[model samples]
Each structure stands twice: as structure tokens, then as C-alpha cells.
Target: MRFLLIEDNRELALATRDRLTLDGHVVDHAADLATAQDYARTMSYDLVLLDIMLPDGDGRDFLAYLRDIRSDTPVIAVTARSEVSDKVGILDLGADDYISKPFDFAELEARCRAVLRRRAGTSSNTQRIGDVAFNRLGGTLTIENRIIELRNRELRLFELLADNPNVIFSKPKLVDRLFSFDEDVSENAIEVYVGRLRKHLAASNVSISTIRGLGYRLDIG
Candidate 1:
């Protein structure tokens, strides 16, 4: 999973980012609302760890902007103990949950898992395409009990396409979702990932099909 942590306290932000990274999530940190906004504009995150007291603006305004823009990505407010009063309004404004300051990092991890499970509408982390099964949480692919080894970027590309199996994603969209702001990725990088994933799925009933000039789709038999 990918996450954006919007926090002003340097120590706390580093701690949180390191912890989430250890747990296999890619995290981007911003110390102020302006920086957070810039990060948000360029990339997509599966979840957001937001601090209500940003240096430049209130976090609620960020929440409202996301809602106004119809971003269904889940937001979890990380607030100080005194900000408990703001929870009701925050939730109403589209926060998935809130974690008070001085929280256990373990608790935050569990909350993230729970909310993401709900978002996926399943307690299970498995997604199937014909006989091939992808364990999204574990980041593993299986077919009839056999495991397939794919490179990290190939796995990410496969996961992105699997997430929206019905939709055709252009190479530009793949570049945005598979790589981050600091990475220099070209459209050719997308093709390489797709080509690799195709070989991995060659024996399976599922296929990653190129739609002429339209880009790619996950075709399930």
C-alpha cells in the first residue's frame, strides 16, 4: 500500500514514515499543508495519515477539498488529544477514522488494515482472476496453489491492473500509479512491466491484453 503522511512535527513524521515503510507501505511525508497539497496533486495514495494541525492550514480544509473533488481515498486524522472535539466534524467531512496523538503505532497499523478491508468490501485480501489468485496484502501471486515470482515493479503493475480489472488503463495512468514523484518513469517502462506480467500469466486463464492504441486491460477467461 501507498500512504501520504501530512505532519509538521519532524520527529513524529519520521517515526511514522519509518514504521509504515517497515510494514511494506510506501510513504510520502509533508511538513505543511502546502507541501501536502503539492504531493496530493501529483500522486495517488491508498490511504492518508493526516495531522489536523498543519503549519499552513487546518486539516479539515484538506478533507473538504478531497471530498469536493470526489476522491474516495480514505483519510485518517492524526490529532492531538485536545482535538477530540473535532472528530465529529472531521468524520462528517469524510475522514475514515481518527487517531489521537501518543497512539501506539501498532494500533495505527491495525486501523489502516481495518479501513482498507472495508474499502475493498472484503475481509479477505485475495483477488482472483480465473484460476490465478492475487493476495493483495501479501503481495504474492498464486495459481492453483503454485506461487509465481515477479519483480517488484511487475507485481505492482499487475496489482494496479487487477484492482480495476474492468477498466483499460493508459500507459500514462500506469506510470503515475506504479511509480512515485521522485522516480523518472517513461511510457516504455510501463510496457516492460506489462510484458513481464504477461509472461508470468502465460499459463493461466487470465491475460493482460493490449487494446491497440487504448493501452491495457485485464482479461479474465
Candidate 2:
């Protein structure tokens, strides 16, 4: 998944970004609310990790702005405020979840998965499509009981397609979701990933069908 991490603490931001990247997620770091707002305005993110205290302004205001824009992007407030009232207020301001400072990275990842699951309206992390089973938490794809090892970007693409199932994803949208702002990607990057996933699913009942000018859709027989 792609994420926008709004944090001012350099060390903490680096640590969190590294951890999420290691889990095959693309993360864009914003040290202030201004950059974060710019990114939010231009790009689509699967999730947003926001800090309440930013160098430029309060993160809660940014959260409110997102809500004001009617953006349903899930946000997890990563703040140092540990008080109960603080958490309640953050939630009331439209944060999907809150995590206090000095949190374990493992727990943070788990919370992210949980929030995404809730957003997807699924109670379980595992989603099955034909003979394919995708474990969102573990980031594993199994086909006919055998694990299909995919590269980071390929796995992310597969996850997006699997999560939506039968929905057509445009190349630009796929590129946005699969690659971060820092990566220099080509126009054919989405095609490359889609071709790779197609090969992996060739023998199964699942397939990726290109709709010519429309884009690609995952079809199940």
C-alpha cells in the first residue's frame, strides 16, 4: 500500500518509513503540514500517518481539512499525546485510529492493517479470489495452495486488484498506488507489473483483462 507520512521528527519519520518500506509499502514523508497538504491534494493514498504536532501547524487541522474535502482516506494519528481526552478529541476530529508516541513498529503495522481491513469492510485479512488467496497482513499470495513470490511493486499491485476484485484500475491510478513520489517511473511501468501478475495467474481461474483504452480488470471464472 502507498502511504503519506506526516511527521516532523526526522529520526522517527525515517524509522517508520523504513519499517513500512521493508513490509513492501511505499511511503512518502512530509515533515510539515504544508507539504503534506500538497501531497494530499495531488495524490491518492491508501492511508495517512499523521502526527498531531507538526513544524508548521497542528496535524489535527490537516485532518479536519481532509474531512472537509470529504476525503475518506483513513488516517492514523501518530502523536505524543497519551491522554484519553486527547485520543477522543483526535478521533472526534476524524482520525480512524490513534497511536501514542514510543510505539512499537510491529504494533503500528498491525494497527495499519486493522484500520485498512475496517475500511475495506472485511473482518479478516485473508481474501480469496478463485484459487488465489491473499493474506493482506502477511503480504503473501497463494495460488492453488502454493505461494507465488512477487516483487514489492507486483505484490502491491496484486493486493490492490485483489482487494477490489473486478474493478477496473486505470494505468495512472495504478502507477500512483504502486510507486512513491520519489521513484522515477516510466509510462509502461503499470503494464510491466500487470504482465507479470498475468503470468503468475495464467494457470489459475483468475486473469487480468485489458479493456483497451479503459485500463485493466481482474477477471475470475
Candidate 3:
């Protein structure tokens, strides 16, 4: 998953970015409102970690601006404010989740996974597609009670496909989503990853099937 971190504290932002990167998420950092808004307007991020107090203005104002533009991207308010009203107000203003400052990095990561899962329409943290049990929070995949370790790209590809089972994604679309910006990607890259994922799922009920001239389908049934 790709994330945007909007924070003013340089040390905290760098530390958070490093932690999220280590957790297998691509993170972009912004020091203030202007930079954050600039990045948000141009790039497609899966989630945003926002600080309520910015150097320039209130984070709520930024949230309102995002909503005004109709950006439904999930935003998690990570600030020093832990008041019930503050949480309620942000939730009412379309924030996905809230975490107070001086928080545990592990807890923040967990909250991030939870919010992203909700956005992905996953009801539970552990999802079962066919016989495969995927722990999104734990970042592991299990088949028939056995654990299967997937490479980073493979895991990301599988996550995207499994998130929308039965939906046939075209090659170009798959390539765009799976690879990050600035990557030197090839048209065959998506196909190659799909092939590897198919073999990984061969023993289980899950499989990625070719859709003739269309693309590929991560079909469980």
C-alpha cells in the first residue's frame, strides 16, 4: 500500500515514514499543508496520515478542502488531540480513523491496516477467499492451514487481485496499480507476476485465470 504522511515534526515524520516503509508500505512525506495538498492533488495514495495541527493551519481545514474536491481517499487523523468531540468532528467530516499523539507505532500500523481494509470493503482483518486465509493485518497468506510466503511484488499483486475476486483486470491496468511511480515497468511484468502467483495458488483453491484477450482473473470458484 502507498501512504501519504502529513506532519510538521521532522523527526517524527521521518521515523514514521521509515517504520511504514519497513512494514511494506510506500510512504510519501510532507512537512506542511501546502506540500501535502500538492502531493494529494497529483498522486494516488491509498491512505493519508494527517496531523491535526499543521504549521500553516488546522488539519480540519485541510480535510474540508479534500472533501470539497470530492476526494474519498481514506484519511487517518494522527494528532495530539484525543478529545471525544475532536474525534467525532473529524469522523463527521469524513475522516476514516483517529489516533492520538504519543501513540505506539505498532498501533498506528494496525489502525492503518484496519482503515484500509474497511476501504477495501473487507469486513474482517483476516479474509478468506476460497480456501486461502489472508491476514491483511498480519501480512501473511495461509492455504489449508499452511503458511505461504510471497515476494513483495507477488504479495501486492495477490492483494489487489484478491481484493476484487472475479473481476478481470486488464494488463495495463494491472501494471499501473501493481508498480509504483518512477518504476521502469514493462508490459510483460504484470503477466510474469500473475504467472508466479498462479503457481503459488495451484495447491490451493485460489488461482489467477487468463481471460482470453482481456487480461487475468483471480478466481476462487
TM-scores for the candidates = 0.83, 0.94, 0.83
- Model 3: per-residue lDDT, tens digit, 44-160? 777899999999999988889889999988999987977888899999998999999899998998898888888888779788888889876666788777787777778777887
How accurate locally is residue 143 in candidate 2, as Cα lDDT from 0 to 100? Answer: 84
In candidate 3, position 217 carries an lDDT of: 85
lDDT (C-alpha, whole model) for all candidates: 0.82, 0.89, 0.83
Instruction: Give the runs in model 2 whose Cα sits over 4 Å from its true position.
Output: none
**What TM-score should be assigned to candidate 2?**
0.94
lDDT by residue for model 2 over 102-160, one digit each (tens)?
99998999999999889878889888788888777666778877887778888888888
For residues 20-139, write the lDDT of model 1, one tens digit per residue: 776656688889988888888888888999999888999988888888989998999998855545788888889999988889999998888878767867677777678898876576
Q: After superposition, how far is residue 126 of candidate 1 from its true place, in Å?
A: 1.9
Ten residues in sequence with the least summed lDDT for candidate 3: 174-183
Q: Root-mean-square deviation of each candidate, in angstroms?
A: 2.6, 1.4, 2.7
Q: What TM value does model 3 have?
A: 0.83
Candidate with the larger TM-score of 2 and 3: 2
Clashes of each: 0, 0, 0
Q: Which stretches of candidate 1 lie over 4 Å from their true place?
A: 18-26, 82-85, 104-106, 149-151
Tell me the TM-score of model 1. Answer: 0.83
